[model samples]
Target: MAKSFASQGDLTEKKITFDEVGPDLWAFTAEGDPNSGVIIGDDSVMVVEAQATPRLAEKVIERVRSVTDKPISHVVLTHYHAVRVLGASAYGADQIIMSDAARGMVAERGQEDWDSEFQRFPRLFEGYESIPGLTWPTTTFTDRMTVYLGKRRVDIMHLGRAHTAGDAVVHVPDGGVMFTGDIVEDHSACYCGDGYFGDWGTTLDAIAAYDVDAIAPGRGGALIGRDAVTRAIASTRDFVDSTYAPAARVAARGGSLKEAWDAVRAECDPKFRDYAIYEHCLPFNVARAYDEARGIAHPRIWTAARDLEMWDALQG
Candidate 1:
């Protein structure tokens, strides 16, 4: 029988944008792909999220070069997903930062996640060989850490458990811009393969309370203005709810994984069918939702073998 998988090449690289959010704060966004934020200080710079590989990161570096010559001295990884953290080496930052919880997640399942993600989406991992190794944090803090880029203050906070147990957001108070990693998405789908669905909603609420004027979400274009920010947050929440809630209910009703998958498809496909990565994310989302509804607190680590098994079980 033919393999029941879509080609990863279907996703193509698009142009990236650099938009000013505030004084010395900018959002580096691409069309519905992973985004990176730049916080420029008087002397140095801080990168919010790294792309999937060094080659990919250079694209952002080129953009950063066009506006400022400030050296990128730090990289803040919002979470421990392979696609997000693996490109840290390209930044050549003096310090790599993450939440304590995020560091622990890397120590626990980082390797497995690396293998699983590469297998799931080969297109994103274009220069797979360039990955130095699993990206590890040089500095980690619990709750929050305040860093000074000359006179500017950048607050890095864990906020709460959402996308992962250690999701961090970079809040630029002076700039009134927030770099929300996977916590907020504009038009892209949320990949809840390793998420806390219930806690994720509350986490978003906390982020909204920041009264941000602009937002650089994990994926999609940069959100401008208060209304755009609110709309992006709401859309992200709706995507999570519509994707996981029906599956959770079906699982509670004693339905099998396949059954729950069907229910989720029926409920969410109409709305999210055309969104980027929707097809790539559904199986993993359902697997996670099923586990959560069954009272599983921590998300299971996904290995390449398990990915295939889940896909086969649900898609067959």
Candidate 2:
């Protein structure tokens, strides 16, 4: 039997976990779902990666309120994916920050992504109706920007392109912790539908250089030690390399997309078949890797219609 298109069959809700990874730093994670990070400064707070919708974002707010009453003053978007940015409104943060490249992506394909993702995975958009619209960052920096929450210093930097063209990492120097968005995942699969395949490994290298004590990744559990952090980064690199290598081999041989798909499945399945969102992300990852190997530097925008067409062609 054919698999469900994207995450349509993933209807069961996941249990959420709120854990402290560093000094006054928290990770709001659900089983394989998009995760958010909380940074409580001396005065207010900063949130990383808003959930898919306001209703889901409210859950993060509930977790935030559990530990600190400090107001959430800033919402930092690591990239421009709808699941990550659409909930920015829920925070009512005075400043919504993103990299300039990320903002450009928001303008280029934000609505298309929202449509495609909503059609692909219904569970994440629990309160889709409440989404105001495409989320726009109030402030955008080309490379790096630092925000102060009273005495605490949080450095947000566009280290390199991995998950998306404008991926950002939030580093807290005092605690040696980093909120690495989708750039580094723990047990979950990396969604490379909009990723930069050739640049991903280098980006991971830059992140590894930080030597962060802990990391709140894009999904799965938080990394609380240097060992866990190192392992997660290496595994993420392996996932990316594994996905791209076989797909690229097929593309280089002038093979069909289906051939590329089969190649990727053969290489990735044994290792990542049980990983979260593995099925949901496989087709897209293969497509992008194939494209990149064939000389397509930029990822194609995925509209709702395009999603269905690709799924049918690859998995039908």
Candidate 3:
């Protein structure tokens, strides 16, 4: 039997939490769902990673209002995934910031991703009609951009490609906090369909070089200490390497995608089965690993139709 695409089969309402990990900084997390970070500067506020839809973002907004009444001055999009970028319009930000590569990703496959992700996860896109359209960043930076709110400074850096070609990290040196958007997850499946497995490890290494006190990952609970942060980053690296290594080797040896996926499943499932979204990510992760093994540098656009076709073939 074919399984449901992405997270559509998951219907349980998650318990949401807003935890202040540092001075004037909070993390909005819904169990293992996409997490957003809030930075309240002296004069304004910056939100990291928009939820999935406009209505969904309202929940995050309500939380933000409870803490500070400052207008949401800047919205930082860590990457261009539909689940992360579509709800940006609801923030009413003066400038939506992203890496130049992310802006290019929006231009290339944002619409297709919109259609693809909506079909895969209906619960995330609760008010699908409320989305004004594709979220576009008014400000684009290549390497890094500094955002100042009074004396507070939030540095957004394009830490090489990991989850996507445009993956960016939000670092607050003064706050000793870093918002790693999907680059590092604790007990959550790293969605590798659009990932660069090889480059991802190096990116994680660079992020680990920093003396981060806490981390607001794209998914999962906020890492509150240096040990917890170190563990989460290491786990993310392990998952990425364990999934890609076998698939790449199999593909090089004239093996098929199914064979590679089976190898990856046998290796990773026992260790990661209890992780969030592990079941949903397996098929896509293996597929991309196989493609990269075959020397496909870029990920193919995943559409709603293609999602089902891939599910029927892989899950059956």
Give me the candidate number with maximum lDDT.
2
TM-score winner between 1 and 3, please give it.
3
Lowest-sum lDDT 10-residue window in model 2: 1-10
Give the Å error, residue 264, model 3.
0.8
Q: Write the per-residue lDDT of candidate 1 for residues 114-199, one digit (tens) a residue.
A: 99988878877878889999999999999999999999999999889878899999999988999999989888888898999989
lDDT of each: 0.89, 0.93, 0.91
Candidate 1 yields a Cα-based lDDT of 0.89
- Write the residue-wise lDDT of candidate 2 on 12-117 in tens digits: 9999999999889999999899999999999899999998999899999999999999999999999999899898899989999999999999999999999999
What C-alpha root-mean-square deviation, in Å, does candidate 3 show against the real structure?
1.0
Q: Residue pairs in steric clash, candidate 1?
A: none
* Stretches of candidate 2 exceeding 4 Å from the true structure: 1-3
Q: Which ten residues in a row have the lowest lDDT in candidate 3?
A: 307-316
Report how far residue 180 has shifted in candidate 2, in Å: 0.6
RMSD of each: 1.2, 1.1, 1.0
Off by over 4 Å in 1: 2-4
How far in Å is the alpha carbon of 67 misplaced in model 2?
0.7
Score candidate 3 by lDDT: 0.91
RMSD of 2: 1.1
Quote each prediction's TM-score: 0.97, 0.98, 0.98
